[model samples]
Target chain A: MRMDRLRELREAKGLSREGLARVAGVSAKTIEAHEYGRTSDVSVSIAYRIAAALELPLDDLFSASLKAVTLKEAV
Target chain B: MRMDRLRELREAKGLSREGLARVAGVSAKTIEAHEYGRTSDVSVSIAYRIAAALELPLDDLFSASLKAVTLKEAV
Candidate 1:
């Protein structure tokens, strides 16, 4: 649910929150909620949209490598 | 929102739907709904959980290459 990298990436591109949200086809609130970790209900589809809009790989936006590893072990 | 790869990967791993759901920490219905495209509310987090459970990369599970490319151009 963390998106520090996303914030950095978006800012580096000189895009406002709403600017990216508009182009990504998601609500501004969705982008704000994700960047601020306001909720844990982030959808995979939206994340992919954001990543695509940013022209980066999806894995690059999350800081959850440890979590992915843990979940992998759980399976 | 397609997950044909997911169904195939799970079956190849010799896991029943419920079995994989148990291991992935998601409900069987979540797996079922996603597999059938019953809804488009697929969350990014759940998809990652499923992918982690399958021991496969997330990008491999989707058939939306064209969409991703489109979004990239939009931003």
Candidate 2:
């Protein structure tokens, strides 16, 4: 999936791809590719690692806005 | 950021990490790591790749739930 937030967050944290890769037990190439939008396919486990690295909740990384709805009382 | 949705979506599409990697121009290892929660740091460009490969909107891939708020009518 897309990761614009991931990149922004990483940069804000001053973490290099290599450094993040080392911490996450992934390869620099992998990190590089992901950083470059080279892949969408990923596993739940990996998502967890990334979330842990970013110190963000898993839901925060993959959820979106909800549709708005209004309700009215019935007579 | 986490990618639990990515994993679920990819699997639903019946694509392997290698297959997605090829399409996204990323290495299989990268996909694997991302799937296994091995990395949190990523670039915006890479996020685009993953989104493209998955055929999902960029916003869908990284956006999360919003905080709920209720307002009261003023007198």
User: How well is each residue in A1-75 modelled by candidate 1, as lDDT tens digits?
Assistant: 455477788998899999999878888988888778786656566777888778787777777774555466555
Each prediction's RMSD to truth: 3.3, 16.2
| List of clashing residue pairs for candidate 1 | A43-B43, A43-B44, A44-B43, A44-B44
> A66, model 2: CA deviation in Å?
28
Q: Pick the candidate with the highest lDDT.
A: 1
Stretches of candidate 1 exceeding 4 Å from the true structure: A2-4, A65-75, B65-75
TM-scores for candidates 1 onward, in order: 0.79, 0.42
In DockQ terms, which candidate is top? 1
DockQ for candidate 2, C-alpha atoms: 0.03
Give a tens-digit lDDT track for model 2, residues A1-75. 444355666777789887776665566776676568797545434544565566675434542421000001000
Q: Least lDDT summed over 10 consecutive residues: which range in candidate 2 chain B?
A: B66-75
Q: What is the lDDT of residue B47 in candidate 2?
A: 51
TM-score of chain A of each: 0.78, 0.68
B1-75, model 1: which lDDT tens digit per residue? 556467778888999999989978889998888678776656666777787778877777776764555456445
